[model samples]
Target: MYSFSTRSSFIATPHESMAELWSAISAALPVTEAEFPLDFSEKVEPSVVDVLKRCRQQLYTRSGRWRQNAQIILDLSWEKLNTGTWRDVDKEWRCLYSYGCLFKVAALCCDDASPATVQEAIRTCDLGLLMGAAIMDNILQTIVRILQNEIGKRHSNEEDPSDGVSAKKMKVDCVSVPVVKQALAVPRIHCPSLESFKKDYLDPQKSVILEGIIDHWPAFKNHPWSIEYLQTVAGCRTVPVEVGSRYTDEEWSQTLLTVNEFIDRYIVVKDASSLGYLAQHQLFDQVPELKDDICIPDYCCLGEGDEDDITINAWFGPGGTVSPLHQDPQQNFLAQVVGRKYIRLYSPEDTEKLYPHQLQLLHNTSQVEVESPDVVRFPEFVKAPYLECVLQPGEVLFIPVKHWHYVRSLELSFSVSFWWS
Candidate 1:
């Protein structure tokens, strides 16, 4: 039963409206003190219910000031409701439901419930149950669709005008290969069974180049992941791309760019002086459709945990991009997608010889430049034994945990790395 006070056109005061709403809520969903103690007085401070009621009143009385006041109240309510013991789960849930009801009422009163706003409410209020229920109303549903469409138009208008396609032509200096002692070759295999993979390489903590594995992937066949294809799929998506040759250089820095712009200026147009690399990014999360193109290797099953535990990351860049020698925490399977990469691996025992960075930020990374080493400053680097290989397209490389490795792209490349414990 929806009833308003007869005293005035406006709803009741904060306390009176909260009591009334609480009463209505209780009537709708009755609960006993035995199951969940109604002791909001002891646990919750500043009273989330009071703030919500005030928010509702603001929405009903002053529509212009509602967004600001409601945001404040929502923030306060979230701060109060987010923390509690698991033993008080029932009590917390009841409070959450009431809080969600207040959000619905406020949204309805304001008549400005955008999809983004509703989505936020779902995340912030009772994990979406109440907001989902409220949006079942035709008016709210229509409002959400209209707001979403408007938002899409606004985003389209705000897109970058220059897609880096017409950028001035630049020179790309030829990459120079460093001279080093001949290292053991990484064994290459083609479509080995899971049992063979585990027995031959995985258990031994040895790196191997896997061939003919990802030949049938969508990224390989249907979507070539070419500059045009990537620009079409993820052009609007903003991503962090490295703007210099290596992070260790004084001129090196990170910048945000759309996929199209990155492809245009870095990969296609070519900036010979400073290379751009999209490294160590979880691209699948930003463009979920890309995940459909690739599949996790079967050998990952030999690890300790479930498939969900694996951390998938993308490494995309021009031919000259380089990743300075660094070690990762978890075992890695790096799959070459578009082009080739030259990799050098050194055992964990060579940590002293590698000269790890002293600073916390670059602690996992080696200070020595593997391509052009300063033997005077780092004399021990000469003794470090390593394994070298050129990873071809549609091949995967298994790197054991804590193995110091350096990667340099031999051509315009895109690679996916799967990290698992």
Candidate 2:
């Protein structure tokens, strides 16, 4: 059912210049092609024609309301769906959003590859991804990759790069939390036998740190995931960022930002009011190039599914970012890639003692603050007794389903987690 064939160079023509890239992209478009069917015998929809016309005339004016126009159309499109959710919008609207981005792309390409211009173009494509549908034969992916890869190439030219892609930039090196109840540390197992792991830890529903196994991943060797490499490849892309010390805080909020913007604002700034975290994001689907660097552990095969069935997420942020005591539905392997994290995990049987939130939205999250416990409010929390581990790079911490865990970063951190039922 599957086959593979190899080809030489993908680009038979010269697309070395940004203009050339733009030209190739433009030619790929048939000037009058319709994005959707008209239902009647009409050659193209009026909306399609309107969008094409506006994109063509964009160069004539520097003052443009690109998002303004898209938003207007988006509002009308949502009405057709009986619900206003953007995720549930119609395909026609998606095509319209795509055209809107096409207009912005053309406008941006008019300028040379100044860092500002390329960055803006990259941001525009990300906007399209946020709003647009999978129309235009992945035009947004095409142009953005063209721009991103070009920039990455430029960055590669300037650095004496290493297999060491790490975030060694956080001001705080080792954040020590006072161990409550004389620490019961998670045991370290060096690639244990499947039977041993299942009997000793898995069957007993205990946490363990897997060591001396994941070091062979490309992310640890040839193509390490350093801040520099991440900036070069995905800095332009947009992702949801958590702005606060932790999600459990009253002032916490989520916002969309370019990866570079998150780095500059929260990771690089000397002082800031709150921490910014790129947490629990399915980054691999948006940027498949990054997925190639890490390999799924063979341990997952012990379960019923393989890599395709597992859910992988990325956690990247500055030191001091905390994940309040929480439990997930599936088993997890939280792999540290860049820096260190102090984790304290409790058994599922201790759920009643942990004081989980009653709210439906945060039911899985425990209310007892792991660091500064309120003794009078949550006295039973001290009785629950958790195991602590300082998860370092190259280590994988196994957390069984329904296990309560609190995690805090010790440095500028980048971690990948895989969850499987």
TM-score of each: 0.64, 0.78
lDDT of 1 by residue, 303-329 (tens): 998999999999888777888999999
Local distance difference test, candidate 1: 0.65
Residue 176's lDDT in candidate 1: 56
> Which sections of candidate 2 miss by over 4 Å?
1-18, 27-115, 130-133, 152-170, 177-183, 194-200
Note the Cα lDDT for every prediction shown.
0.65, 0.73
- What is the alpha-carbon lDDT for the whole of candidate 2? 0.73
| lDDT, candidate 1, at 350 | 87
Q: Give lDDT tens digits, candidate 2, residues 304-382.
A: 7766899999999988899999999998999999988999999888899999999999999999888899989999988
Candidate 2 TM-score, true structure as reference:
0.78
Best by lDDT: 2
